[model samples]
Target: MGIFLTILKILGIVLASIVGLLLLIILLVLFVPVTYKVSGEYGDKIGGRVKVGWLFASATGNIKKTDDGMDGIAKLKVFGISIKKIRLMGHDDTEDKHKVKPKKEKKNKKSGTGKAPDERTETGNSQMSDLENDLVNSPVNGLKNNTGAADTTGINGNVRVGETGGKADSINGNESFDIDGESDINKEIDRIFGTGDETPEEDKTADENSGKTADEDVNKTADEDSEKEKVGIIEKLRLKALKILEKISGTKDKVLDKKDTLIRKKDHFIEFLDKPYTKNTIARGKKLLKKVFKNLLPRKGNANVLFGLKTPEKTGAMLGKVCMFYPLYHKWLHITPEFYEKKIEADLWFKGRIFIGSMAIPALFLVLSKDFKRTRNLAKKI
Candidate 1:
């Protein structure tokens, strides 16, 4: 009996300690006055101030665009005591301005005729023109010289330069004539007409090789087309399966536009809950719950919410009628039913309370009980 009593006492002490810690945390959350103010334009400038309690801590910072980039300053304070201050200076705009002036001058020179051609350009152009003239004149001159010499010397005849009527048979057997120029012309002619005796065999072999390559290419292309068709069909089937799975699982692609807002076509909550319980459904539910809690929880000292509509008057009128008929709609939706303009903004401020204030205990109890009920209902459905 003594052992049992001792065990009960230990358990009671542990429970009381846990309860006391929880109360302490709750009190800190309620009493800590963390306040912040932020005002900024889209791209021009931004500034913010944050304060914790009356004199416990505070910080302030401001940044603005300069001619070059940006400049800013920040300061931190604890118990009204300045702990640190920092200043950031912008880049030197004078240097960039000087750099840009030279570029503009170069552009102006290029746009005008005052630009001088460098030596490299002049030399390259001269060399290229010289090479082109030589290439064009060499072939024509070679042909003209060869034709004149050939006409003077009949077939199977040899001509000696600076000598007239040189007979091919009369030339000394041991005499070595300079045939270099004539040989070059003959080679050029042969290259042009393909009249060499050995060329026909080479041409025939090349033709055969080309024909084989053409046939192989045709076969390879056909094979590749067939493989592509097969792959396309498989891809189509896989995509169709994925789409079907997505529809059945109530999962959708969430796309965010330039405004950083999700483009939701329909209510995802209704879609998710309507689907039967599955691993994907459960995962999606958890994701949805996380998003809900994140939005519900207070992240900073101040909160600002903005809503906009294309036709606010009509929508607000319809919503007002619904709320009039169904009072519970007002509890579920925490916004004004009548909207005068296309845009609405709300700012929320919180005042800290005692750790275990009169309202904190009941509020915490209600929150926990509601969460427990919701969890139990979800488990039953699953």
Candidate 2:
């Protein structure tokens, strides 16, 4: 009975200890400051607004109570970390109210003369030449000053103006009128020559237009005549060759313009050559060598002959003798620069070959032993 009582006391103590430990941990957690990240996922329904203080995390005080009673504000210090939530914070006033008016485009005056616009020209009608005056004074007769020719336009035939004689004027089967002083002389001329003025301004304009049209026609005829003078095939070829030669000359000039840059290319080449290699440089070097050797090999011819000509047994033996001393050509292109005291990094100061040599001693020794074993077998066979 005493043993049972002692066992019950021990169990009680264990339980109490566990409970005390749990309480302690909770108290410690409550006092310590902690950071929490609260994020929202894509939801079906719209959620209420969440507002924080200056930073969305620190001292956040949200007023969830919007226009409704369900809205509530929360001022939180999550694990001693000051954070608050402010709901009911509405949208911002971000739009501009005052609108700017667009500028109106000014209209340009018509190009042709229409009723001779009332522009105050210092040069008046008196200053105009006789022809201009005649054109202006001539009866409107349904024709603008600039509107080319008025005569020879109608269907019936020529008719005398102010005299009322024979049939009306006509041109291209269309009936027209006499714009000029349609005297008997004009009617006779029309009957004999089949030509009459339906409009005076139009007649004068016709003369002017005919003069311009004749000049343009003459120019077009000259151009057509020149084109008729055809060149032979050899001449055409010569012209094309000349053009090609001119293009080559232009390219040569451009190259000359950039001569200074090409002269300084060596400096940049040296800079690239001196740059140190990173961890992947050895692999990249092997790839470059492979590509170069691949290109050097014959493409359209036999590969065995191409490679065999360059490396016979004599060359291999020579290379082997060199390898005996240096093991291999694991250089930074074998033209590695020596850097004694140039304030460079300590790791890259030594030649790449030396570094490779130091690292590869064990591997090289293994390879050399293997080679020696092969050499012994060959000697025994001989």
Candidate 3:
């Protein structure tokens, strides 16, 4: 009885250990999901728009924004992501260092009109000088304003032409204002520094000389007109020849279309007769028909030369043999009595028409006629 009690006690302790281990495993599974959620949230801050799929617990980091934009830093997941800072620089500072000082305004010189020239020249000179300095400092911006036709003098200053003590225009000194109401200095500088218009002027002079020469040839213009008329006549003849060739091609196309249609219809009729006939006899009939039809029918184009009984001699001979001996041909066709009777009737009707319209009387007349001597005389003249 004591041994049995000891066994029961040992079994109870073993069962209790098994339940405790199972509970511990369930707790670990639940805790693992929570740990994953926390790690994913931290990873969001460290890697902008990117996720670390399986990072070690010891690894991880954050990003910071600077004056310019966002900057990425080292984190445990990324280990080695790097970024650098940028700075912007410009050219105005160097340009201003090189500009010359503005010159002092000179006293006005007197002219016969009793007006002081200095009144016109003094302020305009200073303003123009300031503008030049500004253009030197910021060439790109100045160029934009000038090209856009915006006010391009120095800040709040107006620039006027023909009011300066500088060298005057050679042709018209101080006589007229510049077209753009600005100083003539720009135009003078362009004339001196920019490419001159010599080549374009030379081209215009040559064109004028050629025009004069063409006008001098006007007295003999009737001869030239006659030559042009001859050329036009040749072109018209060439075009007419091309049109004739095209018409021939169109006729060929029509002949081909007719031939293909007739061949397909004949094939269908042949197939209908085949089931009633022996294979060997049917094959022979089809072969003979194919050879005869090919010989008689036009091979190309729309117009059948054989239309309205117009076949050449070789075609006529093959067709003639087939029509004249059709009873013997039908023996080779080997069709049943009922089908053979119908086919023979159709062939007879077709042959009667052929002999009356194409072969018997008129063919005999042509054979017996004595017109060859006249035809030969006509050919000799040609």
TM-score of each: 0.28, 0.17, 0.17
- Name model 2 segments beyond 4 Å from true: 1-228, 231-240, 249-264, 267-382
User: For model 1, how does the per-residue alpha-carbon lDDT over 263-310 read when each residue is reduced to its tens digit?
Assistant: 232344454355554334455456655654544444434444444454
Q: Give the lowest summed-lDDT range of ten residues in model 1.
A: 162-171
Put the candidates in TM-score order, highest first. Answer: 1, 2, 3
lDDT of 2 by residue, 1-382 (tens): 9999999999999999999999876654443323222222112222332322222234433322334434334556545575554443454223234546678989987686535445435245446666676665443333223333333222334322332333444434456555445544445767997665477898899999999999999999998877765545568889999999999999999999789677667565554444443223434445555644543332221111111113255445544554565533343112212223222111111110112222234444544554444444443443
Error of 1 at 167 (Å): 3.2
Which ten-residue region of model 2 has the weakest summed lDDT? 344-353
Error of 1 at 211 (Å): 20
The runs of at least 3 residues in candidate 3 whose Cα sits more than 4 Å from the true structure, single-residue gaps closed, are 1-214, 218-226, 229-237, 253-257, 260-264, 267-274, 277-382
Off by over 4 Å in 1: 1-55, 61-74, 84-360, 367-371, 378-382
Model 1 residue 260 distance off true place after TM-score fit, in angstroms: 34
Best by TM-score: 1
The numbered model that scores best in lDDT is 1
lDDT values for all models: 0.56, 0.46, 0.46
User: Deviation in angstroms for 316 in model 2?
Assistant: 51
lDDT of 1: 0.56
